[model samples]
Target: MSIARNVPFETTLQVRDTCLCLHTQRAARALARRFDEALRPVGLTSGQFSLLNALNRPEPPSIGAVAQLLAMDRTTLTAALKPLEREGLVAVAADPGDRRSRLLRLTGRGQEVLASAVPIWRDLHAAIEAGLPASGPDNLRGALAALSQPALR
Candidate 1:
């Protein structure tokens, strides 16, 4: 014998269909799966590709800076970097300007991997955008950007 909650099944249906967080999470996971499949040939998950891409700048960026851009916490970012570092794809060093701070950069091999991944990313991105409904990719990106803004909190 099980006790039933006060909430009705209709409430669950409503949330399943209309909740922004649920929809966003579902969509994000789907996109990640597609990218991960596409990037597998290069031995990267979508998250790893994104991390390596972020470090492809002219100058090395601080860990805090990259963490902010990636919308991840410092500890999480550090954990994510471990595999890349072990593979000799990313180098993390103390920032000369601030010894306590760490800076991140892609190694030569990382750049080569990212370079190969770019065309794959471009093709899939184009296909995804082209297949979107009337709201379009730009509008979707704008909405996501707006929601991601710190001011929203």
Candidate 2:
């Protein structure tokens, strides 16, 4: 009665072996785990670190801008900011230029946390690159960047 019963085992194996999305997702999850572990002492997850890092700009970015930079939807970005805001690590205020839009900035506490995170990130990043294949990290980064472009999708 299961729909999976209709599909051949070979098809499943093929997808497992050849699917770029599946491989990328697995790799992304593994990388996130590593970064999460590394950042635990600083009390940030990989996603939170990224969100906080994005907000560490001279000019507070609009919610729309930050969402685009983070490859997230406005709603998801807003949701993610809640905990950081409550912790006094981030501030969200209505944009003066546009009443409906919100601007995001890293608070002084957020800067301190981010400063603590940078060296950890750099060390881990260097270690990861050093362990990568001879094709090297640059090639891997280039490929990921190309894949990130919406037009390619």
Candidate 3:
């Protein structure tokens, strides 16, 4: 197969508009894909990693709180948590203050799993950072923040 070089990225159909946004999304997709492949041995997708990290925070954060933190809808977050719960990696408890809500927390085994995944995560994060230097993350966050403002409004 012949390989073409200098191909422009596009997020939408129109060449001009898509060019502005497509590159970042393409980057995210590619990065996530690479992380997923690397994380396969640890049995954690990037989503699962975020979920476990959220749960591993202070015990018994409300489901709503976790969803908000992840910026995921409650239903989506609830559905995702099911697998972790079934796998004995997470435990959802009834909120003591509010019966209508549930609280999510990681189990001991979950902690162990997260600990196991850390090295792999560190390696991936390091590799990415190394490409853009130490401030790479800060720059990314800034760009994302700037991009999100209009959407939020």
- What is the lDDT, from 0 to 100, of the residue 142 in candidate 1? 99
Off by over 4 Å in 3: 1-21, 133-135, 149-152
Rank by lDDT, descending? 1, 2, 3
Q: Candidate 1: global Cα-lDDT?
A: 0.95
| Regions more than 4 Å wrong, model 1 | 1-5, 151-153
For residues 103-151, write the lDDT of model 2, one tens digit per residue. Answer: 9999999999999999999999899988999787989899998887788
Name the candidate, 2 or 3, with the larger TM-score value: 2
Predicted candidate 3 versus true structure: per-residue lDDT over 15-92, tens digit per residue: 555564777778778988988887889789888988898877756799888888887889999999989999899998
Clashes of 1: 0
Question: Compared to the true structure, candidate 2 yields what TM-score?
Answer: 0.94
lDDT of all predictions = 0.95, 0.93, 0.84
Candidate 1 RMSD computed on C-alpha atoms after optimal superposition onto the true structure: 2.5
Native-vs-model 3 lDDT? 0.84
